[model samples]
Target: MSDSNRTDFTNPSTFILLGIPGLEEDHLWISLPFCIMYATAVLGNFTILFIVKMEESLQEPMYYFLCMLSVTDLVLCTSILPKMLSIFWFNSREIDFLACFTQMYFVHSFSKIESGILVAMAFDRYVAICHPLRHSTILTNPLVAKIGLAVVLRGVILTPPTILLARQWPYCQTNIIPHTYCEHMAVVKLACADTHISNYYGLFSLCFVTGPDVFFIAVSYTQILRVIFSLPTKDAQLKAFGTCGSHFCAILAFYIPGLFSLLTYRFGQNVALYFHVLLANVYLLVAPTLNPIIYGLRTRQIRNRVLHLFTHKET
Candidate 1:
């Protein structure tokens, strides 16, 4: 093959993920907190899944959506953290190209699924609040199945193309990923090819997928707010807000850090690298860790079921 052709075709066999910069001495210290967070996330999400499955009375759409969210959180955290923990604990940052791409796919796909589930949960709330009489009819077993299928399909279809495009690029340049995990853009930027298309497509996908979900969620909540205020009693409004408060916290936990990280990556070039990386890690880690806590505390049924189960076990 010609030199030019070989140069174009050559890609690195592996990439290195540079875990939290300037904290090499503190990797053990940093990992202590991360390990705690990961364990909490796994346990919390598992507890949600177990409770949802065991408690027959919790077989409604809201809990079903919670189950989906928990499963997605479990998968998302597992995809990134094991490798990251290894990096932190053992300094094992070398990841094969295929493995890196695989991680990238899961991270992005599960995120999309999470976004879809949040929107679905919002819709569940909307129906329950706005059309209480028809909620069961509207969000039936079949419809829930369809929504789950669509969420998975959306991720499966939309995410692979980005990975495929990324794979085609030659990685003749350095393959050191700055972030702790295999983030899509971080990996794409390492390619020696023109990255404009990949970057633009990512932004486009973000807008096309998450934008609509956020918009619909906003619309759903707006209508929900309208309904809550229109109620005759102040106590009724308070009760209604209490029901949604967990989901609201989950949404904020997931999106705010995410948007901040993206904004910093694009616009805040003056921001410190460690701060950007920290925000990126926070975006992935905090939601999963806090989701179960949020739901456990704010969700009356989940809390009751969890306490009952533990109390029964103790007795």
Candidate 2:
């Protein structure tokens, strides 16, 4: 494992992924749960997308955000699940360096986009519940479209530099990436060259992407809570809080694990690797898997519309 004997990146046919090694022997057993989760996530998000698209009555700013979230989840799951399944099923762990970088880029980029989308969704709930009169004018379709564009722009800008920084590092000892996928720090740790720039850029990225987004989400919820408490009637207060229930659950599920993973990694905790893998899969699988269920179960309008649509199609 020295620089002198390392294979050149250009000539290598495939690179090995040093995934969780103990699971390698039990690939089939590991794959069973992964496949189930992946399928559930994909199908769930797809159903939401279809329901949103096919139902005219469900068209609104809130539903627009939900649709955007579904699409984001679909893309996120598709990006990571396939490679993971291939590794588990076919024992095909080798990946091209460029391909690995590409995977890392998309994984991080879509994750950023999903975070932005969740914030936007929370804001939509805030407006609808806290400022009902202004909600219609403020969150109109054109405004929602603009928000979507901004989310995409945010994701794209954050991704390129990270990928470029990654590509600059020359591999010395090994190309094997631990813990399933091409995580930024894991891959960079294998490089012989200084990763100071990469580490700096990663810190800046964490702040830029998660900082503002999570801040806005908190602000939105705070305003929402204030409005809820000011309501004269218990029913009104309950209704206001209920409006944000789904978004709130989704935010906690998505952000808590992610923030914990970053914190553990930055502080050099022993549990960092364990939490990283656990949370990485959470982003790709858990959030998306639960999103459709949460939305459909929490929102009566969406559920009713879906039922009606299905009834009409069948008739």
- Runs in model 2 with CA error above 4 Å? 1-13, 272-275, 309-315
Compared with the true structure, what per-residue lDDT tens digits does model 2 show for residues 1-315? 666676555323455875555556776786787788778888777877787788887899888888888888888888877888888778788887788888889888988999999999888878888788999999989999999999989999988998899888778566677767787777777777889999888889888789889999999899988888999999988876775766688788888877776666667567746446757677567788888888754788877776787899999
lDDT of 1 by residue, 113-223 (tens): 999998998999999999999988999998998999999899888998889888888888477888898888778877887888887888888789988988999999999
Candidate 2 at residue 1, lDDT? 64
TM-score of each: 0.94, 0.91
Error of 1 at 42 (Å): 0.7
Clashing pairs in 2: none
The per-residue C-alpha lDDT of model 2 at residue 133 equals 93
Query: In model 2, what lDDT does residue 186 have?
Result: 72
Q: Lowest-scoring 10 consecutive residues by lDDT in candidate 2?
A: 6-15
Alpha-carbon error at 221 in model 1, in Å?
A: 0.8
